[model samples]
Target: MMLHPELLRAARTARRPLGLATVLLAAITLTHLAQAVLLAVVLSRIAHGDTAALAPLLLAVLAVVLIRAALGRAQRLTAVTAGATVRIRLRDTLLARLGGLGPTAITGARAGAVRATLVDGVEGVDAYVSRYLPQALITAAVPPLLLVAVALIEPYAALALGLALVLALFGPRWWDRLLARRGKEHWDSYEALAADYLEALQGMATLRAAGAVGRVRERLEKRSAALHRATVAKLRVSLVDTGLTDLAVQGGTAAAVLVACSSAATGRTAATGTYLLLMLASECFRPIRDLSREWHAGYLGVSAADGIAALRTAEPAVADRGTVDARWDTAPEIRFLNVHFTHPGADRPALDGVTFTAPAGRTTAIVGPSGAGKSTLLSLLLRQRDPYRGRVTVAGTATAAYSLASLRRGIAVVSQETYLFHATIAENLRIARPAATDGQLRAAARSA
Candidate 1:
């Protein structure tokens, strides 16, 4: 299966652990082969009626079994660890990118859908990183090792197992492609359903008041149906893929078994060789079988990956980093010279050819009935946006010339709406001055 570039990029963050896990998987495969060999020898000894040597071989088998189990457990745990780490890093990057874009940029789209994608969508990628990815690496490494093991015991069986692997791994190229396509379609429908449902739920009251609830419900039902169909289609692909893998495994194993049994019956092979052939042949396809099953999990992850990648590539809003201090920090004069600006999707410039000056150390009031660009002037001075024509100057220097932080530090606004941090009272006030003391906080409160 093709992994999304974003997922591959994220894997680098947990590369060390995933690599260790993959290597561990190879070790587990070796241990499994060892266990099979030990058991085969013990069985051969019993077949020859050599019960006296059974005790030592039995103990050896037990030790190998225990070690294999432990390695399997460690491999699983490491895969989980690698998955979690990569997921956290990717989610954090997405968050930082979204934050950098600021409210103005995000406000252009559906907030509900964005929220769903940020949370549930990101959460969905863990299966790929933790399960499918490591297994894929293990599959590549394990099969060859298994092939060698079987060849040493019986060459014909190795041939059969190798042929089976070829069919299992590469025979379903078209099916895998279809699976990925179906997976993407499913996720798209699911995300749209979530976004629409959340938005509709939030505005249910308004819809009810306007007597449009029925229409909204109808649209939501249609979206739900689409999602159902998408899921069914994806599931169909998964079932067919699994069936094919099972068929290959059984057919391959049976052929290997027949060759081994015939050689033994004809005295060309020993009992131990026949036993090893059966055991190792079955084990050979185990990893490939696992890869087939994990394919669905990986495909689910691909769905969320697209949204995460989009957020990551969204051009970071122009850096707001303040490099130089504002020209004036206190009671600075504001001048807008032949300035022009237009809001998004607007028919005409809101402040075309606007010219105005507010003198320092004096209060100036902008009065307009409605939509007269009253707030626009304050926004320009705040450096929230830049003028399209001419310049907005503070204390005789263009506002853009100063760093965003330094320029904003020189201005303050009292808005009708208040935005507060989710923190303790003391911590919230600390935003105004990070080093403010308890006494300063009390005094500032009283003064306010």
Candidate 2:
């Protein structure tokens, strides 16, 4: 009931599997109710000194138990599949979004923070998808179902059980506001610690060279301590909520059982009906208890709601579509006309009223000191970003008119710093042209 909307959206992508899992859970619950009735009947008959029904009733109970076990396993498998499907879909979406955003997406934050959002954040939704969400659906259906079954035997007992169910289900909402606040705090601390730790690892050499490793270590310890405190605070709220739920379950079950006992004492129902009502009453709160445990288990997903939402809602830097052809045999002149651009959160534009032309068949060298808009100008040509004002044209056509693939394929850049993948030189070279022949590879290497 307290599910995050973003997490619910992610689950919707795998609704088929989740729906199947829910059906399996419902089947499993029915089996439990069946076993309860059979055992109750068996116990009532045994008390009446009837041994004839023992063997067949016990066998029926065993059979129901076996069927329940099978259904439980199937439900677990379906739920797990749903969770994995959602994770994969979300990761694919995030990766594609990041790709469209290009390198500029990481400019505002450390690479580690992006990675944490992409990886750990998506992983956090698994429990909610696989366990808690499905269990919540079952909880909604099961308690009312048990109430109806008990109503058929004794309406007074059903009334008592239904009231208890309401108390158990709604009692935790009082603490929900507190838990949600603590959960957000915990996630913030966790993300900060993870980001800082990873950034420290990546910059360890620089820290050591500057003799600041000790300072970095101390800072990380402080962050770690903060994270620990946040975690304990969240856990404290969860423990209290859990205690309240347990108290409701116990109190609710006792109230229902007492009503059934009174019904039997008043001769409104026989021993068999009393036993059946008691057995059914015992199970009325089972789904609620399961849901309580699942909420605890899936708390990580709740905490990570913001991170997941951020990734899903990120906008691409530029559209990937274009209509103009970019298959010319010869290089075209590149021109920037009164261009303007700004980095997010910056005081001023990186480029303002910039105009330049690099004629075809001529080499153009753009040289500037650090923090200049030189790199920004080139990024516009690659469509890594669109100009805020004016146009970048190639061969008299605006660069935005050409598809990213064709435009990028027509240009080659030798960056100041080279990055090689963890592969052989040939493999890394082939990344740019996967079908390059051996002679073509040699030519490219020689050209480099």
Candidate 3:
């Protein structure tokens, strides 16, 4: 199965740890082979009624086992560390990009759906990095090495095992694209459910007042059912893929075992050789089985990776805001000079070569009919969005030169729609000026 391209790039961020884990996994596979060889020797010695070589063989087996255990522990630690590092870095990048998109772009988004993608979606990819990546490398490298060892003793057994290995790795290609499509559907369904559930929660009071809570509940249930169906469809493809892999593994082992038994019965291969052949054949398919199992385990994560990749590719609401001056403490004359601004995907300019000036120290009002871009004009003044063409200057200084934070500090707007913070009434009122006295707040409220 193919990993998402963005995920591969994210994985590169933790390359040092993943590389170390790969080496450790390779060592573990080698240790397992050594232990198997020791077992084969011990068994052959027992068949010959020789106990003299038993102690050394057993000691070697113990040593291999201990080494394998140590490698296993180290590999796990590395995997966890690498996975965490990748997740943290990717989440940070995702958040930063979202922030760069500005408030207008993000405000309409479903908070709960975005939260799910940011939290659960990021968490989901841990297995892909921790288990699937290291294991995949071992799966590719170890099987061939084992095949060679088997070939040295019994060529026919080796050939049979090699064919099965090829099929196990290649047979899933035809269905993999379809599985990816299903996986994507599952992820989208989950996001829809989260969005609907969160929207219902936030609008609970409104729903109750309107007596539409039951309707919303039914809609959420439908979304939940859709998610379940998508999950089941994806799982069906995964199970079938896993089953095919198991079939190849079992078939290859049986073929190898049959050849070994026939050679032993005809006296063409010694008991030690037959024993080694059986043990090595088992080793050969171990990686394939692991690859299949981990692929299934990490498949859902691939869907998450796709979501993150898609989000990263989206164009921001505005072009990069270049730079700005320090804080703005006092208002100044605001001028829009032949400004021509067009939003992304708009067919006409919102500003359309507009020229206007609001003199400082005076009350100025902009009146226009609905959809005449009055809000667009305010957005330009605040630098929440920038114009594609024209100059917006405050007190003869280009507004673009002033940092957005500094520019916004000196200007205030009572938006057409009020948005109260989820805090006490006093706290919400105090948001405009944290230092306002109780008397001052009461006076301002009365004035408004």
Point out the worst 10-residue segment of candidate 2 by lDDT. Answer: 105-114
lDDT of 1 by residue, 1-448 (tens): 4567887888889989989888888788778778888888888889999889899989998898899999989998998898889879888988888866755566565776677667776666777777788788878877788899788877888888888888887777658678778878887888788888888887888998999999988999999999999999988987887777788889999999898998899887888888878888878888888887777666766777877788788864345754667745478888999999887779988899989899999988889877889887887777666777879888988887788767776676667766677888889777867999999999877876
Q: Which ten residues in a row have the lowest lDDT in candidate 1?
A: 315-324
Query: Candidate 3, residues 160-258: lDDT per residue as tens digits?
Result: 999999888888777888988998899889988988888888889999999998899899889989999999999898888888888999999999999
Candidate 3 Cα misplacement greater than 4 A, ranges: 106-109, 321-329, 337-356, 361-374, 388-391, 400-448
Q: Which candidate leads the pack in lDDT?
A: 2
Q: Among all windows of ten consecutive residues in candidate 3, which has the lowest summed lDDT?
A: 320-329
Flag regions of model 1 displaced more than 4 Å.
317-322, 326-331, 361-363, 367-385, 405-448
Better of 1 and 3 by TM-score: 1
Task: List per-prediction Cα lDDT, in the order shown.
Answer: 0.81, 0.87, 0.84
Model 2 per-residue lDDT tens digits across residues 1-448: 5979989988988989999999999899889889988998998999899988799999999999999988988989998999999999988987887766778765765676777777777888888888999899999888897889899999988888877787788878888999999999998888888889899997898999999999999999999999999999989998988888888888878887888888888989998999999898888888888998888888888888887788667776788779876887788899999999998888999999999999998988988899898889878998888988999999999998898888888888788979999999999999878999999999998998
Largest TM-score belongs to which candidate? 2
What C-alpha lDDT, on a 0 to 100 scale, does residue 101 get in candidate 3? 71
